[model samples]
Each structure stands twice: as C-alpha cells, then as structure tokens.
Target: MVIILIRTVKYNLSKLRDLYLHTTCLATLANMAPHVHRLSAYASQRLVSLFYMLSRKYNKLTEQMDDKVGKGGSVEHDSLAKDMSAELHIYADFLRIVLEILNAILTYALPRNPEVVYAIMHRQEVFQPFKNHPRFSELIENIYMVLDFFNSRMDAQTQNGEWSVEKVLQFIISNCRSWRGEGMKMFNQLHFSYEQESHPEEFFTPYIWRLTLSHCGLSFDHNAVNLFTVDLPAEQLDNAGEEHDEPRQNGR
Candidate 1:
C-alpha cells in the first residue's frame, strides 16, 4: 500500500508541471497576439493617404511662404492662403480618423501599454503635420489665443517691461520641446524646418512676440524700441578679458 501511494504522488506531480507549462505558453502567445495582428492587418486607408498627400502640398506652401516673404512680395500670399484653406478641409477629415484611432487605442490597447497612450496625450504635433493645412488654422488659432492669454497675464505681472525677447522666445521653445515623444513626429518635423531656416534669429524673435500680442487683442507697436541690448555689461567684459589673459598665461 505504501508503494502504491508513492506512485500516485509522482503521477500527480507530473500532471501539475505539464499544466503550468501549458499555461505559460498561452500567456506568452496572448501577449504577442496584438502586435502580430496589428502588423498583419495594417493598410493605409484613403483618409490617411489623403492626409499624406496634403502634408506634402502644405510643405510646398511653407516653402512658398518663405520665398515670397524673402522676396518682399505679397502676390503669392493670397494664392497660398487659398491652397492652405482647401488643404485644411482634407486635414479635418484626416483628424477624424486619427481621433477614432486614438479612441480605439485608449479604450482597447491602453490597458496593456499606458505609456504609449500617455505619450500620445501629451504630444502637440500629433496634429502639427496638418499645421500648414487650412483645416488646422482654427486649431492653430486656438493655440495662439491661449498663448496670447498667457502672455497678457505675464505682461500684467511684469508691467509690460518685465519679459525680455529672450524670455518670450525661451517660452516658445520650451512649449515646442514639451512635445517630444511618440505621435508628435509631425511637430518634430516642423520644428526641424524652423531650426534649419536661414532667417535672422532677431526677425523670428520679434515676429513671434508680435504674433502673441496681436492674438491677445493688443496691437504691437512695430516701432517699439527693444529695451534689451545684446551687448554684455562691463563686468562681463572684464570677465572675458580675464579669461583671455588666463589662456595667454597657460600658453606661456
């Protein structure tokens, strides 16, 4: 009877191990299934493809804007504006599909990968590829309005003189930087162009500032003197001299 009991115990242990192994295999497959399915089922839909085409057109518009502005010509502005408006309508349709994708991902896929969802949520340029599209003008305008409001509040706190051009430019750069992550590739692309442009930094500095002011119901004085000078103070000059002297001493 003791021998019989030992044999039964060994058989049960074998079954338990088999069961655990099977369960593990199933769990791994379950984890991998979604990725496999997404890859296999992926196909570019009409709406998405249309957006891609429009994005290229919008890029050309941006180039045109730069060219026209550089040449000091207004003739192309109206044509560019019209094209941008038409592209915006197409972009709106694309946005609807994107929204649906976001909703589905949030409702279904987010439980498994919350990090991706969070990244998408915080990204601003998820919609930025459409920025040059006329459809995105309203959204861009809304963003400008919000920034304008913030600038106004800052102006009030600093009595209109507290914020320097550098400060405002820094704020814009910071806002743009916060968009770095998945789903914000469009914004990243736009930023790349902005950085690559040969336009004078001073031109953009005041242009952005004036844009914010105009958005906030304030007319910027185009002739308003820049109180901030690029020149360093006398102390900084002295420090530079000392640094130069130290380098010479080291050479000696």
Candidate 2:
C-alpha cells in the first residue's frame, strides 16, 4: 500500500510527506509489514531522483523570474506577475519540503532500517551535486552528514579489503547497535520538525481542496450545505435528505 501510494503520487510533491508518514506508521506496527525496509530503500532512491529533477526545474524557473524582475516586472505593477512570482516562491517551498521529508526519513529511520542506510551509501554520488546548491545546500547538509557517516564506515570496512552488496548489508545490520549512540550522534543532536509550519493553512488548504476536487467529482454546489453530490433518484434523494434533517431522540 505504501509503495502504491508513493508511486501514484510520485509527481505530486505536496503529497509525498503524507505518504512518508504513512510508511512510518506502517513501520511502527510490529509484524504487520515485513518488507517496509525494502520500501524505504526504494522510496529513498525515488525521492533522490525526484529531488534532482525538481532542482533543475527550480533553477530554470529561478532564472526566468530573475530575468523578469530585471526587466522591471514588479509585482505591485502587475497582478499576473505577482501570481507568477508567488509561484516561484511556492515551488521553492515545495523543494524544501521534499528535502525535509528525505532528511526526516534519514534522521528517524536510517538507524532502525538498514536498507535505508544501504541505499544512502550506494547513492552518495547522486547527492554530490546538491552540496553547493544555493537553495538546497543548507537542507542538504543534514543529508550529507548521514552520507558522510556511511561513507566513512564503508571506507573503514573496505580498506585493504573488498566491497560487495552482501558485505555492505551485513556491515550495516551488524552495526545497528551503535547507530543510536556514537554512530549517529550527529543525527541525535540535530533537530527538525515537520509540524513547525508557520502558515500551515497555505499547505493544508490546497492539499485538501485538490484531493476533494479530484476524488469527489467536480460538481460542487455553492449554496448547498453539503458541498458534493451523487447520482441518486429524486425520490431517494428527498427521503435521504428528510432522514438527515430529522432530529434524533437521545441514543435512539
């Protein structure tokens, strides 16, 4: 279910965090999900791909917005320009939220889920480009901390030796005991909260509105107390409405 939701909403950045939280809930339920680690591995990789893709789009949009502003495209002077300018900021925030989700997984789950550590270890190269990214650099720092920890451990293990997927996996699982202490001390010291949104309505309103409009059909009645409708016979609808309007006796 988590994989299905992640893939279904892969392009929808606004929904990814909820899916991550859903995965976390599943992981917390003991014995219910045996393959969640694999899901985490896949999710981490997919999110890495998404981060880079969105970063490129963000860079292009930033350049375009800068050009527009340079040409006297003032928000106060043009309502459309203002909307477009707001879009750039929104897109940047979306990108930041993506990093937040990824970092949250790494911070909260990497130690418990060996597969996530394994995935991050192998994908270290993909993260190099973001080290100096103007918009994402600070957010990516926490991720780099994790990556560096794994890289240092891998180097220590492989020095004057060899490397293999089995060996790496074994090392990660074997060292799980240390992750909560010295191995992940940096992670423990850092703090980030998804609940710290200053303007949550900005995020929640659009998400709820989009989900409702998309799933509950497009026919919304502004005057109706109930906003949505269904295809029902007029007789049945009247009866249903009467039943709904009727007052109920206590406990009856």
Candidate 3:
C-alpha cells in the first residue's frame, strides 16, 4: 500500500514536471490580451490549489509512516529513514515544480496596470475567493505585493513617494531563478540520509533577508512536512542483498 501511494505521488510529479516545463497549465484560462485581470485571478487560484495538493500528499505520507509503528511506536532512525526516503526525494522535485510554475506566471502573466488588479479584485466571482485571502496566505501575499505595486502606480500623481517597480521585479526574478536552480540541484542530489558524504542540509541554506522581501520564495523546508526521520526500507535491503550476490563482470 505504501509503495502504491509513493508511485501515485511520483506519477503526479512526473506530469507536473512536464506541464511546468511546457507552460501548458491552465489551458482553458488561456492568455488573452484583454483578459489579463481574469487570468491573474485564475493563476492565483491555481497556485493555491497546487500547494494544497502537494502538501496534503506529503502530510499523508508522513501520517502513513506514523501509523506503521502503532501510534508513534519506536520510530527509530532506521525505520523513519526507510519510510521517508522516497518522499524526501519527491518533495524536492515537487518543490521545484512549484517554483517553475511561479516563475512562469510572474514572468509572463502579471497584470500590466493597477486597474487590472482592481478588475480582478472587484469581479463578483473573484471577490469571494480572494475575499478570504488570508486563508491562502502565501499565494495571496504575493498577489497583494504585485497589486500594491500596480496600485501605487495608479495613485502616483497623488502620492509623494518614489519607488522603482523595475528594481523590485528584477530582485524577484533573480531570486526565483536562483531558487529554481537550487531546487533542481537538490533534486539531483536525492540522498536524504543525515550521514551522506554531503548532508542534504548543505543544499538548503535560506537566502539572507538583506534583499527584497519577495525573494523569500516557498518556505517548504522550514514550514512544510519534512523528511527528517531515518529508516532503511526492506526493498533497499533486498537490493543490497542482490548486489552482493551478483557475480563480478570479470570474476574479479
């Protein structure tokens, strides 16, 4: 059952990776010049939905491991690592999928003006979903930031302050690209054991806050369900046994 669950999550990740790379998400919510406002709402909604899916799956896997040991029974190092190994690797890839989606949307789909954000915010359909913005805090915070930028532009003549959207957006873009690169690097380095030659923690040093706030990116490692436990699965042991049993190619 656990293996099946793992494979199902793996399949979803595979599809998400393809979709992220191709930028084919939200097909029905296609990019029409006049519908930029509507598209932004849809994109925001999509981001929240994806987060729910991935986090729920991760929590489910963690719960499954917890279930196996008779209600937190003897969750020792080896048992925890065994169950969580596949999930940690998958979590890295899933996070990369999310970052890629974010980069694509922010790069190509942000509203060109403040009125578009108003259009989105004021729309009857969007109003209800966005009304409870705090519920989708992470995604909505980003929407609010971008919308605030556009709103300031709209009210610029009346305001006395100066700000550069270009610089801020550039800061955001650089962080997205850097974080995406780090996510991919982490995916490539899939070993989750604490004792690996280089600890997985080496890949996850968070960005210092001296830069723009938007660079915080997804705080998955810190906030979400983590694969911090340790266990070796029976399959891994079986594979090790087979490897030991196999004859050398040159009988050496």
**Cα displacement (Å) at residue 252, model 2:** 61
Per-residue lDDT tens digits for candidate 2, residues 8-58, read 444444455354553333223312222234446666565566656666666
Better of 1 and 3 by TM-score: 3
What local lDDT score does residue 78 receive in model 2, on the 0 to 100 scale?
84
C-alpha positional error of residue 82 in candidate 2 after TM-score superposition, expressed in Å: 3.3
Best by lDDT: 2
Q: Which stretches of candidate 1 lie over 4 Å from their true place?
A: 1-40, 44-54, 75-81, 92-100, 111-252
The regions of model 2 sitting more than 4 angstroms off are: 11-40, 70-81, 129-138, 159-162, 181-252
Which one wins by TM-score: 1 or 2? Answer: 2
lDDT of 3: 0.42
- Each model's lDDT comes to 0.41, 0.61, 0.42
What are the per-residue Cα lDDT tens digits for candidate 1 across 1-252?
Answer: 212322332343345534333333323332332332221111212222323443454466567656766777665467865665565444444343333333333333433433332233234344466446554554344333333434454455544456554565444334433332233212211110113457677666876765665568754443343733334447768877898887455567
By TM-score, the candidates rank as 2, 3, 1
Top-TM-score candidate index: 2
As a TM-score, model 3 comes out at 0.29
Write candidate 3's Cα lDDT for 1-252 as tens digits: 222333344455657544332222222122232233324333444444554456566556766766766564554556665757566456534544443334334334433423233333333233233334333334444445544444455454343455355444443334333222221111121112223356645444322321222355533332232433223347767887999999999769
